[model samples]
Target chain A: MKIVKYEDIVLKVKLACLQMTTDLPQDVQNKLEMMAMQEDGQLAKQMLDIIIENANIARQENRPMCQDTGMVVCFVKMGQNIQIEGGLLADAINEGVSLGYEEGYLRKSVVNNPIDRINTLDNTPAIIHYDIVEDDVLIIEVAAKGFGSENMSQLKMFPPAAGIAGMKEFVKQVVIDAGPNPCPPIIVGIGLGGDFEKAALLAKKAAIRNLDEVNPNEKLLALEKELEVEINNLGIGPQGFGGKTTTLKVNIEMFATHIAGLPVAVNINCHAARHIKVVL
Target chain B: MATIKLETPLTIDKIKDLHSGDQVLLSGIIYTGRDAAHKRFIEVLEKNEDLPFDVQGQVIYYVGPTPTKPNQAFGSGGPTTSYRMDAYTPPLINKGLIGMIGKGKRNDEVKAALKGHAVYFAAVGGAAALMGKCVIKAEVIAYEDLQAEAVRRLEVKDLPLIVVNDIKGNDLYVEGPQSYLKEHK
Candidate 1:
């Protein structure tokens, strides 16, 4: 069995947190540059220019890109053949988050309770999902999810008979409904065919995927292209100022579900699209 | 859209001249408030208690900026979604709050109140760092315990924004898209 120290995970997460906040991933940057070239509206293009510039400035100055630095989300893929020495994995992750947010001077955006609405101050209790795998590798995928785009996400359980057309319409409707709120030139993530909660989770993970990563399945890739086009056709554009470049990309992740249900979820990721991955 | 500049304490006459789609640069003093502070503002209004700051001819920016880093005036400060404030806006407007800076769609109530009364400006949503640089000075004037949600007085210079909604009921969120679609077609 492969053994790793607990501090290693904490250290990696801390660095990832700082990196994700200060740097806009190159894949997202390339997509924004391409979309900026394609944008038709004068104002939309101008907005994209400023966004790209802001990303550059953030990286150069070592500053957080947007004020909403986001709630931490870690996707941990644990190996069955490995054991972590020292502290609990969850606690280590939260510690790394606190250290990173505080040290990096990123915003403390987490509230302790939904209703009580008191600030957590440290931005802790990260949302974590675990998957057990057969290997010795512990893969940690971190995403800082800003609530602006997260709040615009949608989920629907349609009858099997509702078919692809209904799925398309609903996804499009969510983008339309979101408008300028989530900040357009948004990435659209669709999760199809899973059970209710699974679909929502899949949608979120899909949203965090790099824009350059196309689905391996030929059919899914084609659907992604179609959805991307349909969304851009709506003219929501950059910051919903109106143009031909509404969505940077559309990512759809699917799974098999019971015959009785057809569940779908849509998660919107703003142009920032912050995420990082580490394998140990 | 034309570019326009407006100083602080925007007057009704100046606000009347602005139609939707004009690019705006706001300079001088403004107050920052978000969901929690707005709620408190309304509660204070209800109790006939004086607001921590005067409301007349003032602009409220819907933002909760990151805490300032060393030697920096402020952290990345940008507009939050405006529609969330839709419920609390009318009361603020009734008290002569004339300008608001934010992003996203506003409801019918906000539109009705803005007509012949106030204007709404759209700051680029994710352009926080750029906007924060425009804030030359910031101080938490009230609700310190609310932390980021505190009502802070900020001195800004040429903070770029778009006149999304103005008196006479012009809404860029609605009209900007429709005009673009028609022109493209």
Candidate 2:
């Protein structure tokens, strides 16, 4: 069994938070530049230019790209052979998040109550998800989730007859209704199959995939591409100023479901899409 | 397209001349307030006491910024959703505040209030880091207990903002989309 020191996890989490929140990952930058060239509307193109400039300024200055630096969410994969020594694992992760937000000058956007809505101050107590895997390494995936795109996320349980066409229609409608609010061109993460909550989770997880990646299943990839074309064709454009590039990518992650149900969920990630991973 | 650079406290005449959709480069003193601050401001007004800051023609930014580094003035200062403050805005408007800086839609009541009084403008939503460059000076004016919700008196220079709502009741959120939306054949 591999023994992982608790401080090591803390260090990794802190580094991951700072890196994810402050920097625009290269894949997203490449996609943004590509979309910029393809964007035809002058106003939408200008908005895209400003967004790109924001990314550059954010990276160079070690500042957050958006003021809504977002709540911290960590996806942890624990290995069967690994044992955490020293401090509690969750506390270490939270400590790392607090340090990262403080040192990086990112905003503490989490409120204690959604109703009273008092600020949490440190952006601590990240929303964490853990999965025990067969491997021997601990994998930490940190994503800085902003409110704008998150507000636009939706899920619906469909009848079995709804099928692929229904899913496509639902996604298209969501994008069209979302318009420029999610910050186009968006990455549409479609989660199919699974139960209601699981489908929603799958949709969110799908957002973490790289923009350049294609779904491995050919039929699913075809559906993704078709959905992509229809969404962009809506003319919602960048910042909803009306342009050709409404979506940068469409990624679908599916799972086997019960015999009687079809579940679909859509989670939109803005152009910033800050995420990073660490293996320890 | 007209721009004004002014210091507080503002007069109604200065803001009355301004219309919605007009570009302005604001400089000098402005206050920072979001949902929390607005609620408190209204609460104080309910007690019939003077607001923490005089409202006449002053601009309020609907922003909750990240805390500053050790010596920096502010961190990641960007606008929040304007609509959240819609319920608290009309009363502030009647009190003499002239402008609001924020992103997204405002409620009809807020629009109606703006029309009743000459007011409304917005800074770009996602442009926080870039916008921070223009905020040359900032300090907490009142409600320090509010933390990020505290009202900050900020001195800006050439801060770029578009007039989204005019005295004539024009709304850019509605107009911008209407003008650009293509009809699907």
Q: How far does residue B153 in candidate 2 sit from its true spot (Å)?
A: 1.0
Give the top-scoring candidate (lDDT).
1
Clashing pairs in 1: none
Candidate 1 TM-score, true structure as reference = 0.99
**What's the TM for model 2?**
0.90
- Docking class for model 2 is acceptable
**DockQ of predicted candidate 2:** 0.45
lDDT of each candidate versus the true structure: 0.90, 0.79
**Any runs in candidate 2 off by more than 4 Å, and if so which?**
A115-118, B1-23, B181-185
CA lDDT of B57 in candidate 2? 71
Give lDDT tens digits, candidate 1, residues A116-235: 877889899899999999989899999998888989999999999989999999999999999999987899989998799999988988999988886999999999999998888887
Alpha-carbon deviation at B41 in model 2, angstroms: 1.9
